[model samples]
Target chain A: MSTVVDQPVARAARRRPGALSLGLSRGALELKQFARTRPYLIFTLLFPVLIVLIFGAAFHGDAGGGVSWTQYFVTGMIASGLLATGFQNLAIQIPIERSRGVLKRLVGTPMPRSAYFIGKIVMVLVVSAISTAILLAMAVAFYGLALPDTATKWFTFAWVSLLGVTACTLLGIAYSSLARTGRAAPSMTTPVALVLQFISGVFFVYTGLPGWMQQIAAFFPLKWIAQGLRSVFLPEEFAAREVAHSWELGRVALVLAAWCVAGLILCLLTFRWTDKD
Target chain B: MKTLIRIFRRERAIVDAVTENLAISVRGLRKAYGRTVAVDGLDLAIPRGEVFALLGPNGAGKTTTVEILEGFRRADGGEVRVLGTDPRNATPAWRSRVGIVLQSTGEFEELTVAEVVHHFARYYAGADDPDKVIDRVGLTEKRDARAEKLSGGQKRRLDVALGIIGRPELLFLDEPTTGFDPEARREFWGLIRDLAAAGTTILLTTHYLDEAEALADRVGVIARGRMVALATPAELGDRRNAMATVSWQGPNGPESERTNAPTAVVAALAERFGGEVPGLTVTRPTLEDVYLAMIDKNAISKEEAA
Candidate 1:
């Protein structure tokens, strides 16, 4: 009776997919799934827009100076968006997916285990870019901030934003791996984010803060991201470049990359796919 | 008997030649949780296109063993060939070939059944049609509905649908009918039977003896990490040749004898009656009886050990 059917089915059952493909597929799938959720959509797009508006009011009557509030606000807004998307979003999604058995489900599938993390990276990048565009629009139209003309300023913006995104993304991933539940991630991430915002000179320039506080900020990844953003949006002469002699671009990039490396290692070590544990 | 044994061994030779004949094979599998041994040196060979049931109680290591096969957890030691590959290093191609139905289900609250299925299908080179899979699981009306809104049974059906939509070769049905209503259970059974008939090799683990007795070709009873018995449902408790209770109209009432041969006792009773015996009955140990006796014996030993 069995002779009438397939022998290849069992053979097919035995195969598993490559890690890269699995990771890419999982990333795409996660992004698609994440986009459909109303809360996630609001957090990704709306949260940053709200931040821009709040700061827009605070910087209301003064956005035309050499380091105009609008220009300064745009750089900060982009950095914050990257932080929100890369750190907060990751911390929220990982623990929830782990709790929900989404992570576990992927583990059972032939999709590469790393694909899930890779997918998250892709998702954060996409959301961050979109958020950056929205802030840029606000800076240009509502706040009357001029677009940078010098190729160097644009280069600084790109590198600085990349640095922010990279550091925040890795830190988020590392922190999420520590979180046991999705509910706890927001609480855990909010404090680190808020603390980093204060320390990164996001609210006020780091030069004005106490020396020790600024030094402590220099040690953290967020400080470099915020510093990079300042290098892009702020004029070269307003100060706060004392952390490293000449913007410390190389050291910042290296430190951010190191965090990414460390994050990958931690994720591999502790990140669980299933809610079974 | 020796010749029959030789023939069965002969089937083993062809097994290697016809690589696709054996859907899954396990040898010397062991798993331990901390100091407690869960699945110890287990062995199993399930042929392609057969529904094999691994029946055990809670904490019998059924779930652990299944997780190892699903490649969700790393085994301490074992040789497992699922389809034809070791699950621990399973490739995406290998993954697409296997389907798993987990016991606890959590879902994306926003995704419709159709959307979830469609999304999973992209992982496999060859995937079943999402609509067809949904219809097969009897969730056509609920296809557009959000997964969060599905009833318990319907949610399970969606889980089943996702498992099969990959068009997997070997499907791991881990107590698939748990928490299902009787009607829903029956319907799920029908779906399972259909999947088996369509050439899917199913490795089912269930606590329900009735379900196993009804659906399985062969049942392997696992107790404390050991396969204590492996045979057809009727032969599980030696039910085929086991003693039966014979009762008939007696001096006071219907007395009974537990004997291997029920016919002889019934014949003697017929002679005493000098006609058709009133209130005559012959009954063997039911699957449930055998199961209870089997577990009862273990509980007694556990108490002794304590």
Candidate 2:
């Protein structure tokens, strides 16, 4: 009986979840349902708008040295909003679904397991794209910040941002495994995001920090993500503060890739199909 | 039923084509949650195409055993098979062949009933029609309603609807009618009976004994992870040969006697009461009586062992 059962499963799994076979129609369905949700709608569209509005208060001409904080604030907002939507939202949403036995139900079906993640990844991308566009609009309208004349900078920015999103999203899935309940996940997301924000120069410049802090913050994908964005929008002819300071696009790409690889591995390692916690 | 089922040509291997076969064949199953032995060397064999009920008190490892069989949890030390597949290493194909209606409802607050069912329908290769499954579970009118908007009983029926939407060979119903009213329970019972008649194997675990008697072809009582008894309703305990308590009113109030030969006892009592034995009763042991006695005996033996 065991051999009879093992043979089919072995044959099926021998070529498990190929690129084409991975995505199911259910993934499209899940994305649609997730997009229509009130919380999802608010987090994806409204929450970022709210965060930008609140931070916009700090960017007024009268505030500080009037260094056009909007230019700097734009990148920070992009970093903050993407992380919040992808990582923070997922951590809480996943636990709630698990608690509701939704995950359990899905595990019992023949639905390709990758379909579950592909749906979330698609939602993250859509939400990130919308948020990025709105942030860019806000930056252009009020801050009057300009971009490179050529399309190369935009292409580089897009690739870097996508890599960062993958890292953040996969890490969110990994962090969600620690949450015991749905309500607890939101609270847990805050501290992790806030701590990363503090160390990764979301609140201040990473250059002013100690060497140890810089070394540590370098490991955080958000730090490179924000830095990578800064390199894109910031003037190429701008005076360099440090002697050896240069934005190596390859390093930025490599770091983001490494983070994504690490995050995906962690997520796969710790994720539970049921509410084992 | 045959004519109605034939209409669903797309539904392949929908019913359990079993002939008095075993749905679940567990051998020496064991599980533990860190020093606490949840299921200690337990075993069960439920027949296919039959409603087999598992009854046990709290902490008797009923849920753990069922979860292990459902492939939700792994057993540490034993081989366990459900619908001919080892549940420890459950696959999508194996999963597609089984259905589970748990007490806790799976809710997607945003999606309407039709949406949720239609979405889940893609998971199985040859699934039942979403509309028909919803209608069968008696939620046809509320097909557009969100799952959370449904009443408690309706929610349970929705759970059942989702569970059976895949057209599973074996269905595990854990306390399916816990919160149902009498009428709702009867309606749920009717749905269960309909599924049973369709040749779908059902393994129901319910605290309600009457529900078991009404649904199960056979019932097994598990105590501390051990199946203490397994038999049909009429054959359980000494139900067939157990002494009938013959009681009758004599000149001195009432007299009672326990006897296997109840006819002879009734004949003798007739002489005392003249033509008819006044207030005569020849009562046999009921299901409840046997159940209580069995459990009580187990408790006493346990205490003695301790």
Candidate 3:
């Protein structure tokens, strides 16, 4: 008996996998699970496409400068796609996972909490990229929107995505703690995402909104993300219609970066492995 | 006298070994939620390689005490050492040594059983072979099936597979056989026995007296947040020495007698019949009988205190 008891203790002295590697492995598993859930995958990817088609058709013609309403709405929907994947999806999913005891089970293992977050972030990044690509394809094929033609414009698109997706994903994780149960998560998360989309210039034109609405939208990451993507999809001359009278690219980076930090802190403070008292 | 002293010295040496190599130790453990006391002044010590069952009625602080030991909840007051480290301060190395099968958990509905097992195996420093673990739990047939497709029994088998995959020295099983069918329960018991035979220190909290009697080396009965009794199944409540019931057919009708001397009573009944006694039978208190009586007494005492 003593010999058997000593066996596991000796095994425990063996090397553990690095957290980063484990996190990446978890990310792959997360992606596989996400892909296998057919309805969730289709709905997540199709939403932005439907938005681009419906709004692009309803609101036609030019909206100042050389950019048409269809082109402008396409960019806005692309930004919303990122939000839908990173923010809306996770805010609802995390609570469901929490209520289901998935988080609790994971916490029971030797895996680090940071690895769990990393895996989630990785999954969101992959899903958001797929969603963005679908929206981009719809923009070019249906709306005749041209792809970004210059190196600088593509650079702008890349950075905006990295910062915006990261910020929204972290904030989604943070907000999930507020949802009490899996049944309540969608109601709690959907409204916030929709309300942000409306106020953040995804639904309506930013310059066309009332000044107070613009001021209110300025405090959130979604507004800056949409604003940043608009600079990429629309022509350079379209920047004149922005609230700042220019793209204000630097401020977009700063605000999104700041929100990323804030989201991380909130996540750290409120995150719980189990919902039980 | 000298021989008796030698036996006493041998027992003392065994006690010293137990003290020096305790797997789990708790003293004056207390926990309260708001104004409600969940666990109150509970003390427990389980020696290494012992399969111990904790039996209690609902709301008896069984789950609270187990969760605190598993480091899922904080104790309001107590000293606890699991694997020689405070559970609150347990490190990844410490977690690696402990496995927990909660009463219920959300399964990865989309992931195949094999995939989920492989994923969790990455978290442990000394995980067993994933294929072998699946085979051991009798899930090899369902290895390719999604978790959502598993029945209740299959899901529990998956849970057990995951619990032991990490090669943990200590395993915590909380009401593991709650929903199992009779045959499934028997099979699960066999698995538990095998793990115990391999020297896993198991802390099992169950409502089943027969399960405790079947697997545990010792059983502790808890009531109102305290350890009411602790002993081997046969000796619990002094059951082995308890009065037995003898019954037989009489000319008047059926008759029975309760006495400590059941064999003598049975012999007298046989002699009176001048042969085999009609409907002759002897009965001793079962583990369930003793367990229920203990719980009933505790309830009566609690009502009196209130």
Candidate 4:
């Protein structure tokens, strides 16, 4: 055995390109793992669409403020889908990974911590994008809703969706720090997500909520994302149902961007790469 | 005889070089959780290419020391250098040169052994071929099996494969064979031997004294957050010169004596019996005996101090 040590081989050479390749591979693996989990895969992709279908069919008449019930509910469900992918999925997954010692194992490796984080963010973006597309398709095909027709409306959808996803994903990562174990993550995050869905108008008409409740919802990203999506897909006059009686596209963008920054800072402060203190 | 001289010269030169350029060096390393100290003013140095085993009872700071060396945790006080750089500030290149096989498997569910290894390979600049690493760990037959489907020992082998795929200059194994069966433990020891043969410096922490005796060129025992003993397994507790025990069967039943000259005692017994003594046996203190004695002494002293 000692003779083998005498060969004097050079140590392995280090390469910078490996980090990016590793991150990409990690993202791919996360996606593959998610897909292999049959229940999670099915629920993540189909739940929002199911909610939209059921609600749109039940509330087929005009939903006041010049918006059809189908259009209104579909827009809300799209927001819900984004929230599910960005916030709920990541909040649960990160804690599970930590508890399982997956994050600790990665920390032990030469893979840069930033690479692991970026890989997770990339997976969140991909899954959210796909889930959003599925919800839109369900809305248009089954609920008789029109797609974003104008270039400006598509543009609004693009930036708003991007900002919303970024904010929720960061928030999710931050929220994961509150969970002590994988088993505790669902209880920690699910109630918060469910509460946000309710007050942010995913399940009910936002305009009909109490004044204080509306003010409470205004502080969160979910409400702004729903409003932003509605502005893109609903008729122009439908903005009358919103606070300030307008789409408030500027405010929506500003609020979402602010939340994105806040979430980033929170995650930076609170997010742990491993379960250990 | 000519080959023997060359090997000796090469080995001596390598040892001299590494002793001058230690792979791991620590001084006054201290860490405390609130009021309880996990590591207390401990000092350690391990030369390159040495398989140094750390032995300790539970919570004796072995894991804490290994964690600090691996850069997984920071010390409250003291200087630590692993591969000539402070682990706290070590860059990605530095990290790439270190490998850690943690006590728990990484549990990369749903991915095959080959896939996980290939994925981890990308994290290093010049990683070993994933297939070769798989075969090296003796997992070629189960290379296609998902990580979650693997048996306990197989998972440990996968952990080692990932740890060495990057060809680390320093490898840390923390109680790596806790759940492994005896056969599996032997297999794991063989893998460790192969890595050491290839000159990968290893810092292994284990509770098993036999394992330390089998694999470590030198062993350090820690107790109460401090190093109680550091020596080669044979030299620990001065076991080489420690009194040996000789036992023999007599007409009455059995007799045993602890003596410095066991061979003399056995000969005297042979003469007295007028033939080979029945059921005579000679034994020295095993590694386990030395280890237990060292730990017990430390515990007693600590209690007295408190």
User: What digit string (tens of lDDT, one per residue) describes model 4 on residues B16-81?
Assistant: 566455789898999999999999999999877889999999989988888888887899999888
Deviation in angstroms for A53 in model 2?
1.9
The residue pairs that clash in candidate 4, if any, are: none
User: What value does the lDDT take at residue B138 in candidate 3?
Assistant: 86
Model 2, which residues run further than 4 Å from truth? A1-24, A62-67, A208-212, A238-244, B1-20, B243-285
- Model 4: lDDT of residue B140: 97
Top candidate, metric lDDT:
3
Model 3 C-alpha lDDT per residue in residues B195-294, reported as the tens digit of each score: 8888799999998889999988889999999999999888999999999999888999999999999888988887888999999888889999999999
Worst 10 residues of 1 chain B by lDDT: B12-21
Runs in model 1 lying further than 4 Å from the true structure: A1-6, A10-28, A51-74, A141-144, A181-184, A239-248, A268-271, A275-277, B1-21, B241-285
Encode model 4's per-residue lDDT on A165-235: one tens digit a residue.
Answer: 89898888888998988999999898998998899988888998899999999999999999999999888
Candidate with more favorable, higher TM-score: 2 or 3: 3
Relative to the unseen true structure, what is the C-alpha lDDT of residue A232 in candidate 2, on a scale of 0 to 100?
77
Looking at model 3 chain A, report the run of 10 residues with the lowest lDDT sum: A1-10
Stretch of 10 with least lDDT, candidate 3 chain B: B12-21
Each candidate's iRMS in angstroms? 4.7, 7.7, 2.9, 3.0
DockQ for candidate 4: 0.51
Deviation from native of the Cα of residue B71 in model 1, angstroms: 2.2
Candidate scoring better on lDDT of 3 and 4: 3
Q: What is residue A200's positional error in candidate 3, in angstroms? A: 1.2
